[model samples]
Target: MSRTSGATTSPGAALAALAGAQFTVMLATSIVNVALPQIRAGVGLSDSGTTWVVNAYGLAFGALLLAGGRAADLLGRRTVLLAGLALFGVSSVAAGLASSSGILITARAVQGLGAAAIAPAALALVMDLFPPGPGRGRALGVWGAVSGAGGAAGVLLGGVLTQALSWPWIFYAVATGAFLVLAAAAAFVTTTPVRESGRFDVLGTATVTLALTALVWGLTTARRSGWTDPQVLGAFAAAAGMTAAFVLIERRHPNPLLPPRLFAAGRVTAGNVLMALLGSVWIALFFFLPLHQQQVLGSSPLLTGLGQLPLAAANMLGSTLAPRISRRIGATATVTGALLTEAAGLLWLSQISAHGSYLADILGPSILIGLGLSTAFVQLTALSVEGVARQDSGLAGGLVNTTRQVGGAIGLAVLATLAGTVTAHAATHQPHLEALTAGYRAAFGISAAVLAATALLAAALTRRGSTPTAGEPVPAGPASTAARAN
Candidate 1:
């Protein structure tokens, strides 16, 4: 075995490279939000039709995340990373130059597929390169910070590029970043052996991907078609059937995409649940916050991005303090406290009016929620991966990410539904501004409830400070206990 670790590199150089790649991936996902309006106008898209541009990418990326992670474990991480980057660059260029909305949407979906491959591979590489300890914790913190920062910076970058040049510039920018990361990855990453020898779970991948796609499509279509519509009902039914099939398939498969044993522990179950709920809330905020700033607050794109800076800054601060806090209070308590703080912030934010001031109404809540989410996310990631064997680390990492993406997709669909329903109901009784405010308030309220529930779950499920002792074989689950005793 190679004794060289990432720590041998210049202090923090490896972390910087990892964070740079993570930032670029996250930036690609978010920067498109600011350009949506321009793209809608340029391509003559209906309001409903335009949303597919974002959803297409999100769905593909979220659905394929597990398979991508498995690929990283089986193939070389470096190879997967490079392939993903190349695919992202090619798709971005296609999206930038497309003349029609259909072509652009297709290209965006391809870009999402690339993201699914790249994100897990990148995360797994980071974990493998940095040995598990305080060094790993710090690197994870930087990763979380970069993820948060990319989200914040997206609004600013998108606004500048869209206003100064065109919406296409967003894709161009992502392509440039992808190309740069590809070059850096090729130069910096050393080759590692494929650790897992099991056959790929092709059937499991297909069923789960289709199941999730059906679920998201059903939820999204429910907004326009009313849940009673045949299309919506059919999609839901298909999702249920496919999910059942996935369960059965996984039980018999020698190498399942998601091992059934991973969920045997209470901590793993709770972590995955909390991740889903918080993930949804986080994505919903990103989707709606910008809309609220531009549409309700009458802020320009650049001004809106700047106004949201408090949240990003607070998130970084929260992440930086989390490891220390965890050491003192334990992961469960720390995460619960953070979640409660976030819940309070979300509740306060739900009361915003069309005439609300940014500083008085938004900033305080934004900061609190940012702090809460940042702290909770780090702890959640730690809990999910703890006690897993070295070889299965990549799988654990992928599952954590998949849970988050799936949760975000669900949250976006549910919030969008609530917003649409509120707006329609209010429009029937009141003015346009009042209707929009009603929609925003309803969405925020629902998100607050979700966060509160997640907090409660985390408190009930996670135990205090359960870090594994050095060199002790990380137990897989209940079945592994018998094997260990032998």
Candidate 2:
């Protein structure tokens, strides 16, 4: 049998495993939010210590993503996937069993390291399973749906597990899921050929990793301590210095961590840029929307999680329709429309009041936001990898994910700081609830404006997009004849 035939024979099983791997990685990010209170009480953690629990995962995940992606290209995708899953599962077990703050934080950081390896490798495998075109588009649509829903599901699952069982159960559940995916991946996923290129650029890798680590650390810290805080400024300075060093290293190194040629492809650059903007709104939405539901509306954690169901459903629908829409209207138009839709939702969401009902204040906007964000995510993700060489597929995956992650971190910090300032000023004259609502309103309104502006920029950037129509397939190289299992 042909290599393509061998890869395509069980596309369903492969997609399922890949999707499961990615889902678990995303789930770990937000699953801890609802359970934070329980975790704090259980471990007797201080506020600062508790904050580190989340930051640790994000820091490690963001920092190591490029390295992981490069490793997958140099090593084998299947090998990296299995190793990542093992580490993630073991770390999760350690997190669940931990009784001290230090142990839990360390475990979460280790879990993130594993996730960094899993995310890029899994995405690259998806690109490998289905070659570029409608088959790839539809496959990525499923990938998009799960990716969007993962955050929503994490919130719901965290509430359920924490309320019914305990916080540690959340960690245990992820561990179990990771092991299952690991097994399925081993059985179904095919190994792709690794490029026999120049040796790894160890200096390039170290510099970039440190840069991202410092940047993420600064952003996360800025949210807690004001942006002008000395330590936060120091971290930012360190990130800038490290990033500069990385660029210099990549320029001189024989084997660069990120090839400069990758950015020569317009879609790769534009896609990453747009994804960052979308990610800003995406992360902030989850943060503020939940706060509004719980703090302003006085909904229980369970109810807040339940309220996200509509948004999740709408997101899935949008993702399902993304390929068809892109085929009909083209990628640029589809992305522009999606961004406008999300902006409208955010504008509406900004009108949220202290005396608001879920149906009246939240549900309508949530639907629009879900549909818009998910579709945009699908299209932009496709655009990022379009025309990328097979050898650079893993790097593309890592770059896109890194942009989203970094963008989210930056967005959350800025928006949260702005909201806090608004709340503080309003509290002097307004009722506490009203003051809180005002701050949320400011955040949503600003986000809407940002998205609207980004829509214009996206249109301009992707004006020359050569994205194929739905029925047209790109010239096949590897893994082109995969069955349309979806």
For this target, which candidate reaches the highest TM-score against the unseen true structure?
Answer: 1
Q: Specify the poorest-scoring 10-residue window by lDDT in model 1.
A: 1-10
Every candidate's lDDT:
0.78, 0.82
Tens digit of per-residue lDDT, candidate 1, span 1-486: 221111124435555666777788778767877777788888877766666777778788889988887787677566777888899999999999988899998998899889887887777777766555666677677777888777777777887788788999989998998888888776677664444437789999999999999999999889988989999999999999999999999999998988766665326667777898888987778778778877788777677768768888998998888777876677778888988889899899999988887987799999998889888888787667665444455566678888888888888888988899999999998888778888988988988888888888777778534443211223456433422332
Query: In model 2, where do residues sit more than 4 Å from their true spots?
Result: 1-8, 44-51, 469-472, 475-486
Instruction: Return the top candidate by lDDT.
Output: 2
Give candidate 2's TM-score.
0.92
TM-scores of all candidate predictions against the true structure: 0.93, 0.92
Relative to the true structure, candidate 1 has a C-alpha RMSD (angstroms) of 3.5
- The digit string of per-residue lDDT tens for model 2 on 1-486 reads 111111335988999999999889888987887777678899988755666777678667777788888777777677887899999999999999999999999999999899988988888888888876678888989998988888778778877888788999999999999999999988998653444545677898788878877877777677678789999999999999999999999889888988876675437888999998998877778767877887789877778778889988998999999999988888889899999999999999999999999999999999999999999999898877766676667778888887787677667667877888899899999999999999999999999999999999999988774445332365443322221221
Minimum summed lDDT over a 10-residue window in model 2 is located at: 477-486
Model 1 lDDT, full chain set = 0.78
Cα distance off (Å), candidate 2, residue 30: 1.9
